[model samples]
Target: MSVEIALTPQNPTHAGLSGRLVCFPHAGGAAERFHDWISGFAPVLDVRAVTLPGRGRLMDQSPVESWPDLIESIVTRLQPLADRPFAIFGHSFGARLAYEVTRALADDEQAPNLLIVAGPAPQMAQRDRKISGLPRPAFLAEIEAINGTPPEVLANTDLMDRMLPALRADFALLETYEADRASKHSPLPCPILAVGSDNDPQVPFHSILGWRHRTRSRFECRLFAGDHFFPFTNPDFADTLFDYVDDALNEHTKDLHRAG
Candidate 1:
């Protein structure tokens, strides 16, 4: 089944930038959420956030239940964009999905310039440990505890009623994900920049550092002072991200010249 993916560029003109930064949203997020971020990364990096089905413009569409199905759908839609120098930035559940998509691209001999994973560890953890399957009240409590769910959304019962199902569905997808250990044998040939929040309970510093084991390329981890959704709270998070990207780009260019 073809999942109707809504791909919208935040800065289309900036798509011609030196490199592309494909931004994948966190769970229960929409591409439009990052519209302002594109401008923050302009001139050097173009940002395009993926709008998955069952959310945003594709809200009416049914969300895919399995990881393989979701990854396949995303790769199909994003393959064309692979022609240019690109990197990926995914948060929370999106981070793992981004890694899977990168692996898919690498298998097809289309590796990106860099991989940025935020708010999640590199490898998949046990599905039985998922807390998203709790009852509605329990789940809402969990969301509240995490502090990622906006106050407006939580206060508005009507909006919460509408969004809760999709949020649960997304949680189910993340909870049930099973990692393919075989793919780790040949990790993508690209640098990995793991970003973790200082207080993100879901992603620990140790787990983020584990990403080093999966890459032959340079691996670096940065800790930001915030919760699970650091970027949302800290206005300067985007600037920090771009700084790392700028450094990576310079090193890559230098390496190319040296090789030449």
Candidate 2:
């Protein structure tokens, strides 16, 4: 409902830094997923993670089912933080959020300096069929097959039950988002760094490379070794992520100097 409930700083002590990295998690993920990243970029970037409803600290609230409403909420929350140089990093479902949020912010003439999208294309990632409306068992099976959920969690009925609401809502959001694919929107003005993995089953190399077309500014794609969850499992992920953030910020500085 408010920015305070949505955006959480991983390292609040490092707030007011010249740059910020706002992170969005995949479906069924909590902001804590980015906790480890704070240590790697805190010295230079104020890392903040988004906590959507029906999960994490917002567990008491119902998950947002509308894609437009979710994007509007995120863009509104991000507005105050965009006062300083900032970048947005999102994975899977969050990648879509980051792109839409960036587009909305850019419309307000307050775009981020960089947009880092991982695990999906700038547009909706292709899906075999709509699973959100499937029967409970079938839906869970489909989610398990996607490999986003851990095997142990799938085995634990209690955990799965607790996670179902948010998971269902998020999947529904994706189902509805498919309708927007044919809609026309302009490319973003800021640079974009699209990260993917060599062996990601959900997102192919071309899907990651697709982000290049979403930006009018610079675009780069980096492939690593792992699956869709590479950002959490890959050892070299932090280094590569921070490196791009640094480069983007440096480039922004150079542009500012030229304009001054």
Tens-place lDDT per residue, model 2, 1-260, is 33233667446567556678899898877787888887767778888899888888887788888867787888877888877788999998888878888888999999999999986664646465889878889999899888877676689898788778888888887777763462356778999899988877888888788778788898889888888788888999988888778777777777888999
Q: In model 2, where do residues sit more than 4 Å from their true spots?
A: 1-5, 10-12, 122-128, 179-183
Q: Compared with the true structure, what per-residue lDDT tens digits does model 1 show for residues 1-260?
A: 67777777545567456667788887777887787777666777777889888778877777767778788888998898876667888888788778889988888888778999885554644455566778889999877876656676789897787677668877787767655463356766888998887887767788778777667888888888888788767777888888877777666667777999
For candidate 1, what is the total of clashing residue pairs? Answer: 0
* Candidate 1 Cα misplacement greater than 4 A, ranges: 10-12, 130-133, 179-185, 250-260
Q: Could you give me the TM-score of model 1 versus the true structure?
A: 0.88
Q: Rate the local accuracy (lDDT) of all candidates.
A: 0.76, 0.81
Q: Candidate 1, 204: how far from true, in Å?
A: 1.9
Backbone clashes under 3 angstroms, per model: 0, 0
Residue 70, candidate 2: how far off, in angstroms? Answer: 0.8
Using Cα atoms with residue i matched to residue i, what is each candidate's TM-score against the true structure?
0.88, 0.91
